[model samples]
Target: MRIHHHIGRRTRSGLLAGLLAATSALAMGIAVAQPGTAEAAASLRSLADAKGRDIGFALDPNRLSESPYKQIADAEFNLVVAENAMKWEVTEPNRNQFSFGQGDAVVNYAVGSNKKVYGHTLVWHNQMPGWTSNLSGSDLLAAMKNHIAGVAGHYKGKVFAWDVVNEAFADGGSGGRRDSILQQRIGNSWIEEAFRAARAADPDAKLCINDYSTDGINAKSTAIYNLVKDFKSRGVPIDCVGFQAHLIIGQVPGDMQANLQRFTDLGVDVRVTELDIRMSTPANSSKLATQAADYKKVMNICLAVARCQGVTVWGITDKYSWIPGTFPGEGAALIWDENYAPKPAYQAVAEALGSGTTPTTPAPTTPVPTTPVPTTPAPTTPAPTTPAPNGSCTVTYVPNSWGNGFTAEIRIRNDGPDPVNAWSFGFYFTAGQQVTNAWNATVSQSGTQVLARNASYNGAVAVGGTVSFGFQGTHTGSNPSPTSFTFNGKVCANG
Candidate 1:
């Protein structure tokens, strides 16, 4: 579901003081930490607080009764968005017959927890009642205005921001307006009318235009960008733009940061709304590690942008994730798993958010040796010694292919006695494949030869250990994998 409205911009600095106090409390061990190593123990909310940005999750009201679900929700997130309770159908199912029970439950929980509420959708194409589609012309416009007024006015000060308009643009090709009932009957002017009504109802809220598949600079995002530009020029009461970054594993766009920068350059805040990266599951360690890296990459991107307000994952845990039902054979989207245990992704997100903050205690200095041992001088005559065997490696390429594009996960295993430090792997694509984006490594291509160097966090490969990275590419005809690979200039066996 999607909604849109025009609300005012919020002052981010105001949140810093309170958040800092909360962060201090957390560091002092007053707050509950997830089960793991010391570094993974910091709550995501506290880490994000130190950076002056909110880390949020969509609340499923039904799950609020569950101990584990509510525990994580209250402890890890600073803001809450109702997954479906605030939508048009749920808010006002039968025209003028408003129901705030479900919506109020979510809002009440957020208020009690001292977390801010983000009202989802005042006007959206999906999840509206059948009666809404029956109306036409002037009647339709009036209904739209009434719905926005009722919903926005009720949650007036409670909601810090609103997704005033959601998914207004078409999906593919040369993106244009979607042919929803509102668009067909009331025309494009309906969007502006909805925003106007929302502004009048709740003048203090920060309003936004939200959409999916526009996390990167693509045709769909460009279309929304044009709309935002036009809205700003005409004094449309929009304050932010929401990128529903519903991503796939290893498919994060290479230009994601640049794309967000362009939107924020237009003088409106940007948010990563509805974030969840899904992969084929029955989860495995390899896929979970990749997911962790992807989540870290996203959080880092948001931190890099000055006007990115915050990030809100669509759901709190994988058990309640919408991916498994919507996209069969795909699950394990959120940082927490089915049993509500923290996964590698939880640590990754915490580390990313904590990157900008100073440690509570200073790191200990390394001790210097007072006396150095004498070293033996080199002999003029060469002394014979047993030679050490060269390191061996194997590369396994697994590709998920489609018509003209594919994503491949490549794993490099070190099969030698000694560890490979600061490793570099090189290979060639023989099927006219061109890599477009990659994760967990720094990959560069010159013709068919591609070189992938380990990232700062994954530079060392221990003996009998493996490191994996993936890339998305386009191919024509046969998409054949490389028959061989080289690790640190030594040819590796193919797997």
Candidate 2:
């Protein structure tokens, strides 16, 4: 009935005004603003249903409370990712020994609340117990099999997917540390063995090869791509490629869509796993902007590709991110702020995930269904393209596929009783500069909006139906700026 409450408002006056307005509005029957239509519709950016994928966010059960978890549920997120709790040490501390207590808590919570669960890993180089170092040959394999069988078997159908192998390829090459017990004895063949074991444990779930450095056109990514391609070709039981987009302030991977497409073309799904945009230092207003911009571009990639199923932020809140501790000095890299409220990054991500940010003025009075953030096993079937209540409308996107720096298609949809006048669409550039693209939507500098404005062909798109402009901006920075634009209007929101 009211706009959901959260922390992190820049000024006290804004917070008070918001609270006052919410108190007044709560009396009405409005559910938190439904997804979105035309104006600020991030949903429009999403791939249509036939191409759906899972949208997941890693959660810390230890840090979660009933209320906050409920709040997350309200945000419309599709999947719930269990953080360290699903790892070896936390779940199975010693050999045949096991303890799903932590992971179980999360699993139960997800199941109880009707959220899908993604089992983080069956095998990884990190989070294993020290005793594993002593394991050799068949004993190690047995332990791995047992771990997979126990955990995967425990949840079975309830779990949507599993990260079967992690960081198996070294960036510098060298056979990926054959020193680890599984690799040392079983050799590279152990990876297949693990996946086979996972399938044996739970054939109903999706299997993935999760890794970093595979986010772009790097040697490591290509190599892994080949591996997945080969595995799929040979029926090796691999179904997805998880790209851990642990990005930097200005280094959004420009090859995002290409990378996902390459793998998907091989007949396997692709996902952005462990996504985080880290800064070189602690939190500041400027850095937060960088993070938001990073989040926006990342989600845009997921939306552009039909096979790029969905994404999962490694951790939802900056307070619990591994960035501060793992990278030292680099912190505040996720969508949720410290007190568990939507950060600019959260709103941006929500929008990118197809929940449009409603605009003011001509005002978005049309009530649209709040498509939950993500429920991707596959893109959902279309939600019955009903016409807008007041009149016929359409949304179209004339995407600029310079496909060089960023990957997106312009989403042009209108949902209003009357056409909007002197209107333009905008998103924050974060880098303090606008992207330069000769092939994008024609720019209209005549307006005051800073970034870009739509030329004649770009403005006043119809309602319900939409249009898109796609591109690959080649912007790179600590947390890069999007270097692609079609001048729909001056850019307003940013990371």
Candidate 3:
């Protein structure tokens, strides 16, 4: 959501085949396959247009000033979602007081550009105003309903869709609800109520439940699947299920198509809401190639699903990717590099849509590749050494040095052909450096030695997958980069 800003020198960051045929036939009063991939289409939207689907991207109000961004957005996408502007904290920062300036700006652009607006999310656990956290029972319900009504009502006719409730389930796809203020105060009914309010405000807008880690039929996704089925059975007003296919560079879920198919079978439309494949920093040819394949794999999944409506990448470019800030040592998650030029992933997406060329700009001789720097680093300390008898891991330690404090970015790559259940990193500073702050990891320091243990979210690194994190530290005199790093007591080669 681009909610986190880090400090460095500066701060950081689908109609399916079979049923699509039947549905298109019934809906259009004729049975047929989507026009054989818009071969002549210039932009992604045009390609989707050929197939009678929408191609979209999440837009950031701040990035609109960049001509290339605006140009590409207008050209490639027919649909737009507010990256963060329409969320609770931004829309209703104060009780009953609403600020639609930022969100409206995006809507205004979309309207002017002849694009459809997909309101990002009326309710989310991550970005909410502090005031709502303490409310209970009726107060919470009132606030929730009021916020949804106000935001959804104002954009009543403007938005084509709204994520009425987002990311409500816990990780591990357990079906267990997350411990959120909304859940605590209003319980499970909050979701149905929010959807109802949204419907009352804007009956035509597609109200959806969106979440990550739900691209496949995992525990989390199964939970959402059941919820959608139950909603449909009770006429709960849900129109779509948004699977935020946020994936790693080489790990697109194998059952993605089947998963979306099951959701569509429940009589609700499914969409790929936020798609991006992140890789280890200092992206090499291999990683970027894998990313391109990953993108194509996801695009194909959506293309094959009849009820899959559209596809929206989380953000437009790698420059503003939320990954680096949150994951550390891992980035280059978008199709465009920091310079607004297309990468192989862009071409891959274009090809999948049957629009073989990048839409906005001509191909550059050498596109600037995304690199690991000090933009966003995860912080951490050492943990007890656990031995890995037969695994290989690589580490990349990059320090953005300054006067006394430097932000360190570390990439931990699982080089072996298997996943590491729990990995630990330890390094010793040659200089007198003391760790000050860290995130995305459990970090501790003892004299010149630092140990970083993986947090629950990032501990497991699949074979060839990388996890990154950064930390801020104060160093006396020179801040020498750690000469050696170890993953579970095994020396890690410099990435």
Candidate 4:
């Protein structure tokens, strides 16, 4: 769901002709592109890559058709997240029937460009097919499973991730689960069931629970933190936690990094899913500078955390940003201005990524302790296999179970005298297990064997440093831990 209130009604049909003309103009190099005459600078993607991170942008196909948006998106970003195409209403407008044309087009374009695609959401309160509102009990639960399976399965491996569940917590009232048709009819377990269904259908895409106002350790964020903790302690198939950084100028949360770190510490990946800083119309020099600082703070924090995967701006340019439509009198929320030129904020992000220091925010003089002071929590289960003899690395495999679906964490440690670079960990699951969602590492599977490579930030570990990643998987009958483990192709000595 959108953090800002979108005014009036939204209709894809209404903007078709205008977008078509914009596309034509862009092809002919006759459009009023905003980036004209702006000096070329290092792209955010390149800078992030240097730091072993990913830079991304959320897109509406209509906006992508415009030359300015397309040019910047293609050059500056390597990840594409569908802004509205994958929502429930758009994908399943008429009950049991499904139409994936819009979402498919977005994925197709991303694949053609060699970009990673993140599906916006599978379950959200704001957008739902009319047919769903009338259902109750089994009907509603059935509908939920059907929709998730259909949409997630249609894209299958094409989408790298999905916002499996979005905005499930209320801002007030003890931070309880938000009241929606799904929860109202199917009970609180709907969330866990949604993840389970998604894993069964795709078995590869990363599934995330996304929301706004979670940038800090506040009541809402606390509620989410507890939920994730419970999910991990048990065996819910949650992969990542998404924080929608829909912020105001000069108001970046001081504890944002700490909040993210706590989630990753729970053996899940964290991402800045939808980021935009909106300000009053006619932004002055000071406002722009403040926005730049806020942008840099976010970039630095993400780059600092090994489990912080990527950062995605809500939209590429202020010209098409949802701020103006949703929040009256508030505009200019993105990195690029209306004319497609890089704003001061863009430069700040680039500089932060280029710098090699850990990003830090000024601490509040008086802070509220949302949870315990975080310590390195040992893996829940002991190492399943023995340690490597000649190799100085060890692995601990832990799995939390529920029904036939489970979430697993893999912790890899360097116990040798030297550091390791570009590390890889491989294992075999004897129980016909298949991974559905993974984070903090690049994961792939070949039959019963699974391989996990380090992410851009976590590849290098010091002599005694430990780096870990996790995923959700499904199994039939008895689920047993892998019998053996390998570190960079060397079998461990101790079992």
Cα lDDT, all candidates: 0.73, 0.57, 0.72, 0.71
Per-model root-mean-square deviation over C-alphas? 19.8, 15.4, 23.1, 15.7
For model 4 the TM-score comes to 0.65
lDDT of 1 by residue, 8-35 (tens): 1110000111233334434433332221
Best by lDDT: 1
Cα RMSD, model 4: 15.7
- In candidate 3, stretches whose alpha carbon ends up further than 4 angstroms from where it belongs are 5-41, 357-495
Question: Which regions of candidate 4 are displaced past 4 Å?
Answer: 1-39, 355-495
Q: What is the full ranking by lDDT, best candidate first? A: 1, 3, 4, 2
| TM-score for candidate 1, residues paired by index | 0.65
lDDT of 4 by residue, 361-428 (tens): 10112111011111222233444554545667677776765556565666667777677777888887
- Error in Å for residue 261 of model 2: 0.9
Worst ten in a row by lDDT for model 4: 362-371
Instruction: Give the C-alpha lDDT of model 2.
Output: 0.57
Candidates in order, TM-scores: namely 0.65, 0.62, 0.66, 0.65
Give the alpha carbon lDDT tens digit for every residue of 1-495 in model 3.
347432210111111113322342244232222222111123465456556677788888787775556656755676888888898999998999999998999999886665679988898877789998788788989998999999999998899899899888888735789888888878889889999999999989999999888887788899998888899999999999998877888788889899999999899999998887888887766777789899999998998999999788877777778888877898888776665545668778878877543222222221111111122223344433534334487877767655565656677787886677777899876656777545445677765567787654445567787766556566666887876778876777776
Candidate 4 local lDDT, residue 206:
83
